[model samples]
Target: MRHSLRFKVALVFSALTIVLLVAQALGVKTFAEAQEEKLITALIRDDIANVMQGYRANPALLPPFDARLNGYVSAADQPLAALPGSIRNLSEGTHEIVLDDREIHVAVVPFEARRLYRVYNFSVYEKQFRHVIDMLMAGTGIFALLTIWLAYGLSGLLVRQVAGLARQVKALRLGGSTPINPGKYDEVELVGLVEAFNDYHRRMADMIEREKEFTCNVSHELRTPLTTIKTSCELLEQDAAQGTKSRARIQQIERAADNMRELVNALLLLAREESTQNVEPVRLARMIETALAPFADRLANKGVETVIDMDRNVHVAANRSALAIVLSNLADNASRHTDRGHLRFSYADGWLRIEDTGSGISAHALPHVFDRFYQASPEQTAGHGVGIGLAIVKKICDRYGWPVELESEPGRGTRVSLRLPAAGPGSASPDALSAVS
Candidate 1:
C-alpha cells in the first residue's frame, strides 16, 4: 500500500506535534517538582533556625506545632531506640522517608546538649501535585487530537492544486486543441509544469496533422496507379484473343493491386487516432471465407488444409473495411508460414481464434513477431513477407478496442485470439444470411 503525499505530510506534522507536547509537559512537571522541593527546604531551614534561637534564649519554650510540621528535641546522648523507629538513626541533615505510609521530610540538628528533629508531612502536597499531573496529561491528549486534525486539513489544502492538475491531465484527450490553463494555478512550479505539458500537446497535435496530410497525399497518389493497373487487367481479361496464361498473369497482377489497396487503407486508418462511425453487423463465417480466398491456391499447393469453425448466425459490429484488413492479414500470415499442416479459424466465447500447425516461432523471435518489419530469421523470410502483416493486424485491433493475443512455441505452431465487438439488435440481413448459408 502506498500513502498519498497529503497523508504522509499530515502524519509527519502530527508526530512532531506529539513529540513537542510530550517534551513540554515533562519540562513543566520537572520544573514544578524542583521548585516545590526548594520551597520545602527553605521553610524547614527557617523553622530550625528559629527553634534553636528560641530554645537558647529560654530553655522552657517549646517548638511551634501544626498539622503539617512537628518539632522534637531530646538529649544529645539519648539512645537511638528512644526516638521514633522511622527516624531513629537520622544524622544532622534533612531526609525524606515513608513513615506510616505517608511521605515525611525530617531535619535533624545538634545543639550543645540537645538534638532537634523537624518532621514535615508532604503527602497532602504530593496529592495536589498528582492532580496537576493528571490535568497536564488530559491537556496533552486533547491538544494532540486537535493538532492531528489541523495537520490533516492543512495537508489537504497544500495538495489541492496538485490533485486538480492530475484530474485535468487525466481528462485530456489526444489531438484536443485545448491546453491546460496555467493561469488557474498560483504556484510557480505548477504553472511551469502546466506550460510544459501544453507545449508537448501542441507539438503532438502538429505531428498528427502532418501525418494526416502525408497519408492523404500518399493515398491519392498511390491509388491512382493501382486503379489504372486494375482497370487494365480487367480490360485484358475481357479480350477474347488473350491467351489463357496471359489472362492468368493479369489476374495475379489484379489481386496484387487489390491487396496493396487494402494495405494502404489499413495504414491510413491506423495513422488516424479516431474511431470509425461506419460500423454495421457483419456475418463472421462469410467474412472469414472472403479473407482466406486469396490464400486458397497457396494453401492447396502446400497441402495445408484451411478450416473455419464459426456459426453462420454469429455476427459482429465493426467497420467493414478495417475488419476485412485485419482478417486478411491474419489469414495471409498463417497461410505463408504453414507448409503442410492445417490452419484453423474458430469463434467462441467472444473470441475469434486462428491456429496454425506450421513451422512454429522460436521463443526469442515470438515476442518481436508483431513488431513492424521484424523478420524472425533469414530462412523464414523467403515466403514470409517483410513482417508487417501481424503488426498491421495489431494496429487495426487496437484501433477498434479489440484485444488480440498471440501464443507460440518452437516446433509446436502458433495461435492468435481476437476479441470482437458484439453486434447490435436486428443487425442480421436476411438475403446475406441465406447467401452465405
Candidate 2:
C-alpha cells in the first residue's frame, strides 16, 4: 500500500516526539535516583554521628531512638551481637544490607573506644523512588499525546498549500478557462514549480492557437481552387456525350471535389478552439438521406444496397452542418468497404447506429481507429483509409458532448453509434421521412 505524504509526515513527527519524551523521562529518573542516593548517604552518616556523640555524653540518652534509625556499639571485650551478617564484615562506610527479609541502608563508623553503626530501611526510600518514576512516566505520556496532536495539526497546515495547488492543476485539465493564479507560497520549491507550470501552460495555449490559425489558412486557401474545379466538372458533365466514359470520369472528378470540400469544412470546424453550437430541432431521417446523397452512386457502383430504419418523427437537437459531415463520412466509409452486403442505419432510443458488413477491423486495430492518421494494414482490405474521417467524427461528437461508440470484429462487421439529445413535441415534419438510397 502506498501512503500519502501528509500521513508519512505525521508519522515521522509522532515518532520524533515519542523518542524525545522517552529520553526526557529517562534523564529525570536518573537525576532523581542520584539525588536520592546522596540524601540517603548523608542521612545515614548524620544519624550515626549523633548517636555516637550522644553515647559519649550520656549512654542512657542513646537507648531510645527513631523507628527509621537504629545503631549498635561495641567495646574492646564486648563485640556488637545480633548485628546483620552484612554489617559484621562491613568496612567503615555506608552499605546496603538485607536483614529479616528487609533491605537496610547502614553507615558504619569505627572509633577507638567502640564501633558505631547507623541503619535505615531501604524500602522507604525505594518507595519514594518508585513514586517519582511513576510521576515521570505519567507526565511523559500526557506530553507525548499532546505533542502528537500538535504535530498532526501542523502537518495539515503545511500540506494545505500543496493540496490547493494540486486542485488547481486538476481544474486546468478539466477545461478550466482561467489562468492559474500562482499565489504566495512559503516553500521555494513550490513557488518555482507553480511558475514553471504557468509558463508551460502559456506556451502550450499559444502553440495551439498558432496551429489552429495555420489549419484555417490552409483549408480556406484550398477551398477556392476546389470550388473552381467542381464548377468546371459540372459544366463539362452537361456538355459531354451521354453514357460516354468521359461523362463517368467527369462524375468521379465532381465526387472527389465534393469530398475535398467536406474535408475542408470539417477541418475548419475542428480548428476552432471554441465554438458556439446553434442548437435547433433537426429532422433526423431527412438529414441522414441528405448526407447519403453524395455517396449513393458510389454505393450503387459497388453493388451495395443501403438500408434506413427509423421513424420520420424522430428529431434531435444538433448543429446541422457538423452532423451532416459526420454522417457523410460514416456512410462513405461503410459504402467503400461493403462491396456486396447492404449497409444498415437504425435509429431508436435517441441513438443512431450505422452497421456495415464490410472488411471489419482487427481486434488490436479496432480500439485505435478513431485516432488521427491511424490506418490498418492494407492487406486487410482496400477499405484501409487515410484515417482522418473517424477522428473528425469523434472531434465533432466531443465538441457537442455527444456519446459516440464504435465496435468491430475481424472478418465480421462494424457498428458505429451516436447518442443525441431528443427534440420536443411537434419538432419533426412529415417531409423528413424521405428515403436516402
Candidate 3:
C-alpha cells in the first residue's frame, strides 16, 4: 500500500489524515460519551431518585407512566417486570431514539437506583473525521503538483546547457575556418569541459592548415629543378655533333644533374622520414656511439669538442631511419655553422637532447628557420649549407607525432629536444633506434 512515491506521498497525507481524524474522532467521541452519560445521569436522578415519593403522592399516575415508557407493558402480569429508567435500559444492544423526528444514538447502562449510568454514542464523531480526511486529500494533490512544477523548472536549465554543448560538437570541424565560442555557464564543470574541447579543436585545425601549406610548397619548389634537369639532358642529346658546343653542353648538364640530384635526394629523405614511424626498444646508446664513429674525423678536423651522456641501456621506440636522418642533419648543420664550439647529445627519460654550441639562429631568421631555400643573411652566412635541414627535421618529427622544441640566442648556442614515446604505446617495428640514434 505504501511502495511508490505516489503511494508514499498519498499514504503520508493519508496517514496524517488518519492520525488527525482519529484524534478528532476520539475527542468528539469522548465529549459525546460524557454528554450522553450526563443526560442519563440527570434523567435517572430527577425521575427515579424520588420514585417512592412520587408513587405515594400520585400512586394512580405511576401506572399510566409505566405503560407509556416501559418496554414490558403488556397490560397483564407486567407489574413485576416494570423497570425505572429510560427505554434505553430495556436491552444491551444497538438502539435508536427519536429526537425532533431525527435519529440520534443512545447506549444505556442499567445500574442501582443510587448509582449513575454510563452511555456511549459514535455517529456524531464520524462526520467530523470524514471532513478531515477530505481536506488532507485536497492538500496532498496541490503539493504533488507543486513538486512537479519545481522539477520541470530545474530540468529546463540542465537540458539547455546540454543542448548548447551538443550543438558545438555537431558544428565541430577538423579544418574549419570558424573558431569555437562557448559561453558562460551556471556550472563550472560545463565551462571547463567546453574550454578544453575548444582548445583541442583549435590546435588540430592549425596543424591541418600547416600541413596543407607544406605540401603545396614542396611540390612547387621541387618541380622547378626537376624540369630544368630534364630540359638540359634533352638538349645535350639533340646536339652531339658539334665538339666545342658539346663540351659546354656536357658541363651544363653536370651542373643541372647535381641540382636535380639534390632535389630528388631531399624529397626522398623527406618521404622516408614521414613513412617510417615504428621504433622498437633498442640500445640507442650503442647506436649513438656508432653514429659518432663516422663523424669523428670530421669533428676532429673542425676542432669541435663532443660530449655524450647516454644511458648504458638506453632504449627508445621510433622509426630509426627517420631519427638518424634528423640527428645527421642537426650534426652536419652544427659542424658547418660553428666557427669553434662543441656538441652534446643525451638520451634519458624518453627524451633526446642535442645541443650545438654554435652561433645561434638569428632572431630575424627564426620565423623562417624551417622554410625551404631560406638561409641566414648572405653577409652573416657562416657556410655553404643549404637551408633545408631544420625544415626536414620538423617534417619528420611531425610525421612521427613527436615534438621538437628549439631554444637559441644570437651568438650563443642552440638546443633541440626530441620527445619519444615508449615502445608499448602503439605497435613496435624492428630494433631500429639502434640504427636511428
- Most accurate candidate by lDDT: 1
Model 2 over residues 1-437: C-alpha lDDT tens digits? 99777787888999998998999899988898899888887776677767678777886654433223234533222222345444556677877767666566666776444456655676765977798799889999999999889888888898888888888989987877576676667788888999999888888888988998798789769988998999999888788365688887788778778767766765576676444555667888877887787778878888888888988667888866678788988987787777778898989888999998888888898888889978776554445577787888898999878899999886777899999888888664334433332
How many angstroms is residue 197 displaced in model 2 relative to the true structure, after the best TM-score fit?
A: 3.6
Best to worst by TM-score, what's the order?
A: 1, 2, 3
Q: Quote the positional error of residue 290 for candidate 1 in Å.
A: 2.5
Which sections of candidate 3 miss by over 4 Å? Answer: 1-277, 377-383, 424-437
RMSD over all Cα atoms, model 3? 17.5
Q: Whole-model lDDT, candidate 1? A: 0.81
Error of 3 at 257 (Å): 19
For model 1, residues 1-437, the per-residue Cα lDDT tens digits are 99998999999999999999999999998999899999989988887787788888997775432212133543222222223554646677988877667666778877554556766667787899889988998999999999999999999999899999887887776334678999899999999999999899889878978988898899999999999999999999999999999988888788778877877776776676546766778888877887887888899999999898888778888777688889998898888788878999999988999999988788898889889989887576685587787888887888888999999877778899999976877777543767779
Q: Residue 132, candidate 2: how far off, in angstroms?
A: 4.6
How high is each candidate's TM-score?
0.75, 0.60, 0.37
RMSD of each: 5.8, 8.5, 17.5
Per-residue accuracy of model 3 over 150-244 as CA lDDT, tens digit each:
54555555567766776667767433455555565667788888889888887877786787678667766777667776777677766757588
Q: How does each model score on lDDT?
A: 0.81, 0.77, 0.61
Give the lDDT of residue 79 in candidate 3.
25
Ordering by lDDT = 1, 2, 3
